[model samples]
Target chain A: MGARRLAEMQVEVTVFATLRKYLPDLPVGGSKYIKVDPGATPADLIQILGLPADEVKIVIRNHVITELDEIVEDGDRIAFAPAIAGG
Target chain B: MTRKIVRINMSNQKATYEDVPKKWAKWGGRGMTSAIVFEEIPPTCHPLGPNNKVVIAPGWVTGTPAAPSSGRTSFGGKSPLTGTIKESNAGGLSGQKIAKLGLAAIILEGTPAKDQWYYLVITKDGVEFKDASDLMGKGMYEIDEILWKDYPKTAVIGIGQAGEMKLSNAGISVNDPENKPGRYAGRGGLGAVLGARGIKAIVIDDAGGPGVDIANKELFEKGRKNLTEAIQEHALTKKDGGLNAYGTDVLMNIVNEAGGLPTRNFSAGQFEGAAKISGEAIAEVVEKRDGKGMTGHGCHPGCIIQCSNIYPDESGEALVSCLEYETAWALGANCGIDNLDIIARMTRECNDLGLDTIEAGNSIAIAMEGGLLEFGDAEGALKLFNEIRNKTPMGRILGQGVEATAKAFGVHRVPTVKGQSMPAYEPRAIKGIGVTYATSTMGADHTSGYTIAPEIAGVSGKLDPLTDEGKADLSLAFQASTAFIDSSGYCLFIAFPILDIQTGFEGMVDTVAGVMGIDLTGDDAIALGKEVLKMERLFNERAGFTKEDDRLPEFMRYEKLPPHDVVWSMTDEELDKVFAWVHED
Candidate 1:
């Protein structure tokens, strides 16, 4: 049953700023839908997305900033950005 | 050599240079400007009247290679918009040129006896008031071109039609490194004050001028080197940092993702079109149209953190010098307009008209809220810009600022504190910055204390933006530290690396100490900031501002913002605690 659930899971991931370089095919301010294993954490998504941990400053899941250990459900919307601050 | 203070009396039509006062010898930039205005200008004086003087001063590290972003000039006076003491700082060649001329401050005092306009030409030799009657009613871009043609080496600080009309939202434009009238000491209606003085422009030429005098050359160099290394090493300010790579518009996506980007005149916490007008998109466009347009440009020379960019038209000609985060958010998302081209054009119009883009955008938003125009109407926005250019009665009303516009149309959802419009951040989503907007001496200025750094960007430490706990202390600390940084003439952007890195902060303090020939610790820096704030608060108190003035709009208290569903949870009791240290002293 777990394997069947893993095969059915997918998530939407978006990258911004310098982190966009990690997903070369994605345009700036663009996002992509990626298939992931069931109950995949944000850390697993980062690995799947091929983003280095040091380059990723903050991550948001479903509009709230989330830790890497937090579980990502199917169809969860995720966004990540590099270190940036401005008025 | 002692720096001289240049005072130009518009009433007498005379300019004089005097020795710097011993008490103000250590003060520079915002410190000097605020100190002078607080001492001379009457708190209750009409902001655009003869009694209110406009004071301009360069920061202590200005004209030196202390830091890459150390070219900020401060403009301080009584604000017609907020009815409070204000110091609006900008990054441009004006600060560097002024400092190189060995002047501590240039005070514009007394209104002109006549209505004729004149320009002040300042060089190493002296300052002279020249006939500028013919240059009246011209846009800042036209004035910039005319001035540069005549005084190619000088930096032109001038106003536009908005200022000539004495509009409260009027700003003073300064030529950037490229000699384009782009950078503005924009806020507080200071340009209206300058216009009241009948000054068209002040041309500053540093040729053959004595540069800044460094007291401890060896110590200064050490501090400079340390800061340079820290800046280069930091991920956010380095050459490949987010800022240098995409400019300040990089914050658009981050803020939007965090659900803090104010959209549609502060009605929404997020905008669907935010990514379309982001810094990354801006860079992509510039790259696609790579003629005169370029990213990673510095506003002034000697800046290593080149966070400014040039936006070009389809034909590859320069359309705008910089499309910053605040401008993009204010004109783009706040107005419900998503097109970058329209936003860039609006920004150019604001710069040319000598209007503060933030205030102008907020005023336009207020107009939309009042049913004068529909939200997201690009053509209507342009038409309003033309109205301001023509100085129509309605245009004049709108040009007065967000508060005046709200009053004119009876808009209840006006997002302002102390009569000044809030910037891009939605206060409900970001409570710490909300606290700052309410309590800042400068009245809803983000640069006065950018609590967004820690709350959203996680520069120093991460704080949940939705939480109300410990926000007062965070706001106070940022406000105090920012005051110190503003006085130093370094761009507030340096606070990012400084907050995260201890040696960077120490290097900045040491650099100022070396320049002033005094010992300074971090605590002393905070104390200096407190002193500046005390002076400003005293002036505001005398001007009739009370604790009641320190508050977000009434709607923000009741209306819940979307996405976060948070109202401004900070209470009046919490608000009063922001400057508690000042009262304690």
Candidate 2:
């Protein structure tokens, strides 16, 4: 139930920070037009978007990071921010 | 012997610059900052109003070759977070930069033009106002990076998201050793006021050709040698694994094992996952998982302790190791989270968004009590921040701080003293800190008089960390002496080997004197501390807070902590007497 066509979901994805290195032709901070895969959980989206699921630190929805299984409705703005350790 | 303060009155957009009053120079660092704040700022004035002043000053040897003394800068203001006068200090290169500018303190007064966000930039050439519009809405790290890249060799200080939100736990950040603006004046909500006033950053550099004019080059060398040696010789200082390798996260398990750790919002004294959250654990994981050179580093330049760590997961993905003991307690144990990754992510969120870890931790714990989410449910807490990141209703309230959290949660058992969240140490279990957490001008601060007294067992020799005997006297003495150490810009760990020695602190005073070509005595150091203490006490008093405000939380004295099964027993009368001055002095 967590997998679907990318174009149907009508949501965009943005992977922040280090997640850029692992994405497909990724944006510096992340991508601007990561069309979400249909029926995909945040976990599936992260995996399909090419982020290591185990290390995908923060996921923001609508300008705020959401939980892993949180629903991604149409037109949702999902931001995947990497965890960077800084003292 | 040194320079004077430049007071910037925002009301008239005027600058009142004067020589360092003979009275102020005697007491440097926190001492001088507090003294000036009390003497000038009217206590009755609103903390966020124009009448309130923000005083930024360097320590005794802020610009000297002294090791840990390099970055200690103090900021004094009527705290929007505490509604009382607050003087918070943190490590960053800004202090040295400000000092080199030939100004001891810079006072920012009134509010700025609402549309324009202005920041202070002090180069050796002169001070000027810079445009911070592009800089606004950026996180601390982003601000630090932009400022440093744009203006090389300049140290920057800034406020983050929480500060922008005007939340109580918000703090100001300064560039750390790696030049990340992650170093914060972590306590109090002064950051909010800065953000509210439309000030985005303060950049101080040595750009105008000539830098800090050396008063006595020959004297500076000797003092530098002594300071470098002193740090190298100290046991805790010599080891990189302690702070530099793991950061303050190392203290988590140790404090828990010692039965002083605050857990589950102070309902307990030990955390179940203390080991996993410890500094040592951080080092092991960072080394093995993240691989090579990911250990803790110092917060400022030339710091030997280097106890602050930058931890990433096995995947080479970042997690926080600045995970200080208090932060670990607040976010880890107080919220019942044992997962290190969640703590790391949460810590970063707090830092990036500019929230106080302790207060946020307490706020989350109270959320657990209120059934907003389950205890230790990392996602729930993460979502809370997402709300802030999203600006949700719950997010705004939760970000507001502990008092609001408690109110929202209908929690009466708040482990706080002055509307501020308490640190990691449980006052009930470690009774001496009770005095400190209660009476500190900053409110509920353990560092004010950390009661590791019994837990630490004293570094010079062995002593009981568990016993209350002589603890009161020890707390007072530590507070007094620590004030002296903090004033000099020397790291607190200097007290480890130097506390009992007559010349231990004297060496510091002598070094500052040598560097500045001023004859500084040990007596003067202690005297400066007393003056600062008196002024802080006076600030609290005039703010309508009396001795009544100087008491521990009800639960601390009434509830018994496990393992030790003890509660705070000191009476109000006894606690009050701790501040009594000796007739001889």
Best by DockQ: 1
User: Stretches of candidate 1 above 4 Å error?
Assistant: A1-8
What is the Å distance of residue B22 in model 1 from its true position? 1.7
lDDT of 1 by residue, B494-529 (tens): 889888888888888889988989989999999999
After TM-score superposition, what is the CA distance of residue B407 in candidate 2 from its true location, in Å? Answer: 1.3
Candidate 2 C-alpha lDDT tens digits along B95-201: 77677667778878777765667777766545577777887677777877788787776788888877776677778887875676656787878787676666778
Categorize the docking of model 2: incorrect
Chain B TM-score, all predictions listed? 0.99, 0.93
Candidates' RMSD to native: 1.2, 15.2
TM-score of each: 0.98, 0.82
After aligning candidate 2 to the native by TM-score, how far in Å is the CA of B155 from where it should be? 1.1
Q: Candidate 1, which CAPRI tier? A: medium
Pairs with backbone N, CA or C atoms under 3 Å apart (clashes), candidate 1? none
Model 2 per-residue lDDT at B425? 76
